[model samples]
Target chain A: MSNPESFRELCRKEIHTGPTSGVLPGYIQANLLILPKCVAESFEDLCTRNPVACPILSKTEGRPQFLRNHASLIKQGTFDIRTDFPRYNVYSRGKLVQQKNNCVNEWSSDHVGFLIGCSFTFEHALEKAGLVPKNVLYNKNVSMFRTTKFLDSAGIFHQCPYVVSMRPYKLTEVEIVREITRKFKKTHGEPLDWGYDGAKRLGI
Target chain B: MSNPESFRELCRKEIHTGPTSGVLPGYIQANLLILPKCVAESFEDLCTRNPVACPILSKTEGRPQFLRNHASLIKQGTFDIRTDFPRYNVYSRGKLVQQKNNCVNEWSSDHVGFLIGCSFTFEHALEKAGLVPKNVLYNKNVSMFRTTKFLDSAGIFHQCPYVVSMRPYKLTEVEIVREITRKFKKTHGEPLDWGYDGAKRLGI
Candidate 1:
């Protein structure tokens, strides 16, 4: 993978459409959600109420363009959101309709976009602490489960079950994992649980 | 000054339009902004770029009803946004148009609202520390100055001067004030600078 900027450029041109794993090693990658203005408020509320599941990276109201440069770049209108991401999961009225390479055709004047913090950021920190994240070792996407734990409902997003990504670790390492991830409050801070009974508590 | 719920009820009934100072003591009060979905993204970007000037408490996509309870309430479709605020400053194309006790008429389906952290939260900490915030001492609104500091431009909010609310303190108490305020990162965190030269440096 090239530098983040060049990687984004390639994505902008539709040359890359796969998972962004191991790309831009030290830089952050985010989960994307775009919705109509009518439902944007509910989504924002959902993120706020469930900070651990939906830690926000950045959000845009109705603009289709995004900033490619780091937060320090003062100038406006840097990147086009329509074609920048590797892939987008498109939903309509709370149903997954399709996954698209780019959302250019789906973009609308009333659409709002959110960049949510992915757990991948803290996974890097775990590796540095001499702890191997299970997913990385397995060479698979992180295991995600829909838990019976209900998210605090926001406007249109009522009573939705909380979704959590899972990674297994030895019982002895649980405290250390919690300590390291807790420091990143913005990136789904800390593990929800560690062992088999822990998973049972979440109803996974 | 009553419990936050009752105070909100009074505001909803159009009885309380005064400054929220000393009302619902120990409960948080917020700075409110309501904008059409058109400018919402720019404002979100503006907040992201200049977090110190605008630490957001909660934002809604297009829902007019704010949470009557604190952020913990999850059930949807709660308070109405129109008559809930003690006051609202209306803006058209980035210009202040009117300050209204209620914005029921001005709010459209296309509008989004933001609850931003007010410096008042830290003022309590200041008072507890034996350092009286200048505004509270003078029995006036906090002194706000437009600085030469430029906020990073977002979509429609371009090259806007950063606005800071000020409270003067003795040189000896500067570090103490900073230490106390730094804990409230969600609110405007700490003094950007202290002393007469500090104000001059910000081009206030």
Candidate 2:
């Protein structure tokens, strides 16, 4: 097992370049949101209204500092918002602007970063329950689909579609899966729906 | 009870100009954070790491749109972030820059806003449990103290002090207060500590 601190050091050194899935088994993983201050309020509203899709874990204060002693893995080190991530999907005016390894030059005094809880937190519980998450089994990213369900609008995020990441399981495993995932409230707790009908209900 | 939507309408029209404390009983009220995009990521990280002190309710989506049908009070209407609040405290480089009733001219697309949950959500529960929050009893804003406890740093927000809003309660009521407040996880959740020693432990 990689020492979480060492893993972070590698990320900081630009040596690790890949998805963070299953990297550090027990530690929590997060999705990231970086945006300008001008539209951050609306994004906050969206996360508030849509907790399932946007379970926020933490955010930075208005100034930059090295994160120290929040979670066990994020211990006593500074991470560059620009170059730390393996990849970043940049958005501009609600459109995918570009993909980059670092955004150091783009960062400024007015930017904000949000670390949202990803579905990975609960996958451990699912594995513990003896139900393997499909993505882990297949070595593929989880399937995500946009839904017809309208997310609550806040500021600039108006009536946007809710997105769902899917993992397949047998009919027999539904009960155990729900029961296990429900405990992870800070993550995307509980499945919204299941089966082929589930996709249809979401109007995928 | 006042119609929540109407109350918001007045605020939108610049007709209501006062603290929203106890305005709409039983409904949630939030503290507002509006900052330039340059520093928003750091602020977001701060909120995420220190949820107890800075429980975030929602954020803007980085665009301007009328918030429609999220919460009952925030029904179909456009809110001018720059002019809607009774007042706004402007911060520059982490310093209190200015306070304004309207920031219309200063607002730009590069700014983001955050609506953080205030302690009011649990106050009603406290009242119902026969333990009145001191702020409510005294008709004052809750007493807030800055603690020596350092908040977990995210991005640019490093080594910031944790700020806590205090509500004094009788020693006999500590258990009940903790029980009642614990249910409101989206807000500031349960009491961190109780009594004078609580402040001392927090290094006030």
Candidate 3:
């Protein structure tokens, strides 16, 4: 569990089938998305425009001859998209259809994969900065809420609201929090807005 | 040529099937994209993040049981995505398979559509401001070039470069051009950077 490569091997063999979060400390954990290439353009564009919300770390090569399953190189070793994830949620028409441990059946020549940056990376930095957010200190999941402030719509991803991961911090520590987070652009950098006015602006 | 409604009608009837650009002056023109809903999330995410290059104006509603063909209400009247575009290019695995006048044979219930903001809308405003871009003044198509500045990759749309539309302007007219485009947020607000230094920064 200490070594990410060995952990990934365990994931491939289905021996360690649980949430990968908090397991790989000191290493960057990525959020993965696998979908068909046809609809990927718009998604990539949206992520590029909204980096704070959706920062991309790595992605699979867009090749026409996706004849074979891809073995993506993460940090230490190659990880197959279909089998590497602890679990997979199959969404159909924006609804969850099924849950699977692996996606060997679902992944195809047309499918593409992306590795999005996780906020956990910055949380590590925040802890180092001594401005640890309330949720982290409490060892609780950062409370998330759907705000009225909608993101720019693209294709069928319309009416997509800005989902905020709330982590309360002292008023005195806000500037330090901003400074620490501002350094990590790939991770959600800096507070978009702070305080009650900020909350109102975000429509939280 | 004047009324957008009549123009759409002409497109539907296959009477005036040509480029829709420069025809409907003073009207907001949009770029269209149609794809399956299953892969739309990533595409939409990419578009949302990179608004300047990909300004999304409107989108089809994401719904389950997409049983029938959708007749979308555009600026003036209901225009079907299949027949309204004047032309359609069928791409499979990122390769052009064929060209069609309509997508009636191709479009299915799983497909989703998006209307992206076109630069032509701002061109109209720019002309009104008495500072026409070089492409418009000489009646030439805006020469667009791909820059080395890649966007934040999402899903399969990785290694996507920033394709810039080049237009020449005098040094004195730069700030005014910036001011003119600044007001149009939905249509690429202001210059990301300007001049040779700007071009260098964008990696042009």
Candidate 4:
């Protein structure tokens, strides 16, 4: 494993395990997608088609190296796909397999990397606005739901519902929430709709 | 009059005579507001209170000089307050008197310069996302209408209706438009309503 002091201390030994939020402050955080190069191009096209759902930050054409914007987050050559992330889920034919923290041995030559814009940037903006993120406050993952809304799909892009992340806010702050989400298109732009009904419809 | 060559040329010769759009492209463009210092604190408070309507970009606490953000566009310590703009309207006690180009000498030391966020940023983001900004292409100002919605007001804010800017697109882009608008709380975030009849009630 590539030896970066922080990585070695926190993740390499399997001690630090959680969603990679609040890990590196002030730097852009990202969502990861690993796919075969054959399917990567089509997926990228789909992202372009429905950018609100898939704001593309950066992508690796052939191998799953960190994209340029995310390069600063790489600790060392130690990006042991298997052990680097606190946790990862393996997928076969679009079906998720056993969850693992590291996948060095499973790493394949044909893998390509896609990094997407995350809510971190907008969340930072929100914090600056003094609207504390309740999920972060409560130390829980922002609730995510699968929506019946279909993202524009391309070749081999399954016509499946989109997965959305949501948070609750006061009725008075609905306008504020609407305003903040407009800025970060790379993140899902805004809620598909408001209220628990919207959540239930999305199968949250 | 900081004597930056480019800004100097634009200001001195009045070459920068336009709506001030796309100038100093990456620099933040501010919507200019000049209010008497006597009313400044209350107005500032109003901005603070109704952040969506008035995103406080930068303010001159007492006088309009040393104005923030768009300073790069000023020339030789001079910004042509009157002739530099494409158009201008004079309002006394919130009443319109004349529409002219510049209001240079008419400005008083008591006049405080307020720069709030404009719709340009969100429009740029929308265009970047392959969504269209029809108003720009039509070469007209984005439609500004009054809304029945009363913005939460402070001193001079007075619970007045809001002035909303609209850029029309196909009905299909409703979701995309909503999403894009949400990001721009510093500006007006989303449309008060998607359609016009409702927006027209306030004499927009």
List RMSD in Å for every model shown: 22.1, 22.6, 20.9, 11.1
Q: Write out the backbone clash pairs for model 1.
A: A40-B61, A41-B60, A41-B61, A61-B41
Query: What lDDT tens digits, residue by residue, belong to model 3 across residues B54-114?
Result: 7777666653212123333343244566777677789998899998788888877788877
Over the stretch A154-199, how does candidate 2's per-residue lDDT look in tens digits? 4456547668888889988887887777666677766766778666
Alpha-carbon error at A41 in model 2, in Å? 1.7
Q: Which ranges in model 3 have alpha carbons more than 4 Å from their true place?
A: A1-204, B15-17, B62-77
Model 1: residues >4 Å from true position, as ranges?
A67-78, B1-204
State in Å the error of residue B51, model 1.
19
lDDT of 3 by residue, A108-196 (tens): 87878877777677787777777676666766667777875544444334446667667788788777776676656676655555687
Work out the iRMS of candidate 2: 14.3
In model 1, the Cα lDDT at residue B110 comes to 88
DockQ of each: 0.02, 0.02, 0.09, 0.03
* Docking band of candidate 2: incorrect
- Residue A4's lDDT within candidate 1 is 62
Best by DockQ: 3
Better of 3 and 4 by DockQ: 3
Return the TM-score for each candidate structure: 0.50, 0.50, 0.50, 0.46
Give the lDDT of residue A72 in candidate 2. 41
Off by over 4 Å in 2: A66-76, B1-204
iRMSD for each candidate structure, in the order shown: 15.9, 14.3, 10.6, 13.8
